[model samples]
Target chain A: MKIIKNLALGVSFIMSTQLVSAASTGTTLETVSPEADRIALQNFYKKRFPNTELQDYVNGIYAVDADSRTQWEDIEAFPPYEFDVEEGERLFNIAFANGKGYADCFENGGIGIRQNFPYWNKEEGTVKTLEQEINECRESNGEKALKWGKGPIAQISAYMAWTSRGKVFDISIPDGDKKALAAYLDGKKFFYSKRGQLNLSCANCHVQGSNIRIRADLASPALGHTSHFPVFRSKWGELGTLHRRYKGCHQDSRSNPLDMQSETFRNLEFFQTYMSNGLVVNGPGSRK
Target chain B: MRKLTTSMCVTGLVALLATSPASALTVEESIAEGKAVYMGKSRGNCISCHQINDPDANLPGNQGPPMFAMAQRFPDKRILRAQVWDATKNNPISIMPPLGKHWILSEEDIDAVVEYIYQF
Candidate 1:
């Protein structure tokens, strides 16, 4: 057993030397195989624990005791990827007693729904976000209403975010429609607008001051803020939709938080999502 | 001349009394105590936003600046102390609440936080 241990140590030393030489010479080392890597790791642990299994060695090296990352993954897969989609599909298909389903409300059976959402609605003369669409669907159907921030309707929005995960965000108010264009402009203004008791705008932390160390890590940009949604917040211990997050932000800003499906929130989403055009949606982000 | 000599004698006695063995708190001890106050539940709760030098602490918020880099930014202890006392006074738009004015921290606690931050 002593001889075997000595042989392993000698082999590991030779392997490390070769790795260093290869790295310096910009050449690959044939001796540095996966088996060698495993053996080297095994030797390292042998010094700590004389008789631990390979599985145990790997597990000890790469162990993450917390479920924060997993929870975020689950949140990103919510709605379409989880049971929430089935509920949304049910709501989408169920016809009201007045013989109307969401299909009757929208011209496209909600197809291309993701494209035009967070868009300035020329007919309504206001911006409409996905959350508002859900509420509107409920109200038009004469169904019992779900409170904007609280219930299954928000979950359905999460489902929409999941379904639209890979779809590029494309929201444009036509130039010819000046009224709608003005609404879009208002959204843009809001993005840069400084409010709250702090007198800080979203731009302060996310745009001009990004990468500034806040406690431990740098702040991220607001450019792609809307790309992640239906995110699982560890603080909340549950998956939350984009509007729910908006409510949290408002509270953080010390502003009167808007209703979950309010027009202001929808417009804000529209503006925020428009800024995130072309970015791949990585929903269900984890944050400290 | 006698009165002048008596005054000098009294001054010498006062100086001797003032020089009696005095023990002052070290900066490190003050910092450690301040860190405890910051992390304590009823006090600053600063761990919610600010990351400390301690490596074991997890999940520090990105809402505020990290305490580790503060020494590099503000070299003067007095300036740093004032900043911690009331950030909004420096930048009117700052979201950070004033620890001193708001009664979020006691004077000793603030001094300790200042000492800790200065060491960082």
Candidate 2:
């Protein structure tokens, strides 16, 4: 009788533990209903961060009001917006070393370009960001690519961001596309990967429990950052593209910034932007 | 009759000149002076990080905020002046050097630049 009681208790404990773990990891669309999927995500975040606040959207984008929140009015007056767009336009029209202009590369004349960014490429088995696509176009055309985070490419990107002002971020992860799933998973891995001199991951500054300080300013969450690209930086005296801001963050972390149009950066952008899918685009924003 | 017309024309010119305030410079003159200051020739050389010019100029930098639509953003001249003079006091991480604290400009120079920015 005693042995049977002990065995029953052990089995019950094991079952409860398994249930908790499954709840935290969430389920793929194939395995769970939409409502269940949302519950799973909520459970996962709640389990991982018991104290942090959580918000959800249908588009998968999440805005985590970071520590320091700057009003839109305050940012609108930043000085960088003064010249970034003009400079960007100049670079866009200029011929690259291979004699191709930025306008010649895109499908829609780059008008709705931001909408399709951070896409999954099945052929390459990877994610491609706007920056990577731009650089790749330059390389394929036999032109010397601009150094990442520097020069004409960055300027053009800033211009693209400026043009995308007020547009809604519309990215979707289609069902049953294994490549897209893998790409998103890769993005998630990148988000949690810790690197740089500070040993920080993207999650460190964006997620709860990580305290970010710049002099005295509070750090806003990374969730909504993608929606406010081509930001006018008061320090830069012009508008800056998303990748340019990424480079800045990299530099701040004491890590060498990737090229402005590099594959890694594109993947990061894809992940970052997808995370901000539902937020309204507000480009040419000002930042400190 | 011709003499009378000439006199009327002169009177009109004088009235036009007299009606305009001496302190209120035209937008073109203010932008020109601001450009000079931005290029580092005037009392305040703001070009170190700021790229100030129309799109035709093509010079770009990433160190300071753009100057477009300043009037719409900060309608109050006093708030704008305080921000220019001491941004760090408002937001500590602000990289902008305090022009007022550094004595980079006399009070008159600061006032002129502030006025010019307001006009923008």
Candidate 3:
């Protein structure tokens, strides 16, 4: 591990030197590999919390703080999202006026398929998320679209997530596709770019300042951050989708929050979910 | 008529800008106000990532370096103020907010913060 760390550092140092020369000549910088980025990010958290297992990161803050873990475990004993899941199943099976349903829109009837989401759509030239697809499914089937963040959409998402428990995240950006790569790179840039009056980025809190407190709240590590979604937050007292959380985080930084399921956000989901490529599905989880 | 009025207003604004500092808070008052801003959760909240180095300080974080010997570390007060204004100018990856640059903290408040921290 130490040798790998040294090697990574050496490689980065060489790349940075090259980058400086490239900048001086007004040449474009080299494109980064998504796989390499994921490996490096996972290694970072592993080094940061030496005792933590990579898989344990799906638990978020609970993976580091024992007190929080205990509280989270007690809450998880009978998950708050149980009702939402049941409602989602009901909504999923119900036929639209056209006699088509969500199952008809997705492969394998949409069961246990949450792990394959935020995928690169070659024909559409866009990144597709399960939430966006759900709405698309509805609109195509002659039904009105559900709200993006909460309510029925969240419930259905929670149900799908519940079905996909333990399935590893397997997001993929199509090979040799420049547009897909561009989307991935854009998301990566946004993840690290500072914004808002606070002048903070997603990396600042989750990357550099994990486990640190901002007033009363502890910052969580970014690893496996996407594994859990459609979370039942005690603060909100209801279930909300991943985009909803992104919106809130942006607002907290005093940056203007992007619209739900927008291209920018869908691309961000692509980059973030790809980072947790090997983490198990553990969505519809509870959080404080 | 409009040009004369505009010039008069510009001159008046310049006079006010020049005299404002003289009429601002005194050294002791500035220091006190600076301390409040530094500690205020909605303001600087420097303690979120920095330790004040005071024994009585509460719940200081270890992300940034300890905040002792400010005068030694930053002999020139403007340099220190510039940091609080925007630390990223020195270190691009710095997590410190651009308080003045982003208008999160007014110039007057930043000056007060500089005065408060300079004592240590």
Candidate 4:
């Protein structure tokens, strides 16, 4: 067993070396296969919480914390987000002044399609997130773009996620495209690299600090970090998109937060959502 | 002679640079500066990791061990400062950043933080 573990380590070291070289050369950096990363991440969570079922990870921190789960279940029974979900639905269907709607701008009229977002737009050579696309939809319709963080974006995204509930996140890295892979790599770097004056990475709290309590709340694991969107935060007292939460966390880390749906954030969403590929969408979630 | 030395020390541009960091900050003022660096929205904000014994703090985080009985933990304050300078020196995989190694905190800022940290 020890030998096998050593072998794995040796292999990872070799892959990392090659990846570094590949990165300098602008070639495909196959630093450990994405499949390997996915397995390792999933197994880490599974080993930590042996009692948790694989699929239940989609529930975020509630999947592991029994104390919080009880309260969350009770809250879930008559979710505080119900009104916001209803509001989102209302906003989503509203036609713009150009006599067009969000439906006119997406595949399958944008219903039940939240999971496929943060896609590598090969032609555009950039990662595109749901919020960015939604803004694009508004722009294409000759309407003004809504702010990507709190108010309208969250409401509309919550409504879309609700409609797409139970659909597994199907984010893709795409094949044979080096630039797309580089974007994913950049996103992965963003996730692991330490930043800000406090010098903490997303992994520090979400991964290393797993099940650790912060004041009154438990820090959620990163495995299904992106499963929930447009969370109804008690702190904010309003609906908030995933980027809003990211911005909040960056501020908490004393890092200067980028604009919502900014390149790095979109990349972060891409990489994190890829980690959450198998988890089902359970957005429009409420959190205290 | 001592009084003359003290006044002369305060007199000129040559001496000004020696005490350039806004004179000798009182203990209370140093602690305040340290806390500001530790609590600012876009700065060190150590409250995000370790809990500290500030009466006015929001009880922010509990990721690292709480900051209490620090003087007891490391009787020599330099050891404490070194630890903050690079926690990875002790533990290779430590999550705490090397504040000094990475230039995250200036020498004066670090001194202030160490003063505040050692007090509690």
> lDDT (CA) for every model shown?
0.55, 0.55, 0.81, 0.75
The lDDT of model 1 is 0.55
- The full ranking of all candidates by TM-score, starting with the best, is 3, 4, 1, 2
Name the lDDT value of residue A247 in candidate 3. 89
Q: Model 1 over residues A91-153: C-alpha lDDT tens digits?
A: 667788888777677646764455456777777888877667777887878976666663476
lDDT of 1 at A139: 88
Against the true structure, candidate 4 has what lDDT? Answer: 0.75
Quote each prediction's TM-score: 0.60, 0.51, 0.83, 0.76
What fraction of the native alpha-carbon contacts across the interface, defined at 8 angstroms, is recovered by model 4? 0.27
State which candidate, 3 or 4, has the greater TM-score.
3
Clash tally for model 3 = 0
- Regions more than 4 Å wrong, model 4: A1-28, B1-61, B66-75, B97-120
The list of candidate 3 runs beyond 4 A from truth reads A1-30, B1-23, B53-62
Best candidate according to lDDT: 3
How far out, in Å, is residue A209 in model 1? 6.1
TM-score of chain A of 3: 0.90
Give the per-residue lDDT digits (tens) of candidate 3, residues B5-119: 5565456446644553342799899988888888888988887767786565678665566677776666445556777787766566667788888888888899888788778
What tens digits encode model 4's per-residue C-alpha lDDT throughout A179-217?
887777777787877788666788777877778765556
Report the lDDT of model 4 for residue A192.
Answer: 73
Clashing residue pairs in candidate 3 are none
Model 2 CAPRI quality: incorrect
Docking class of 3: incorrect
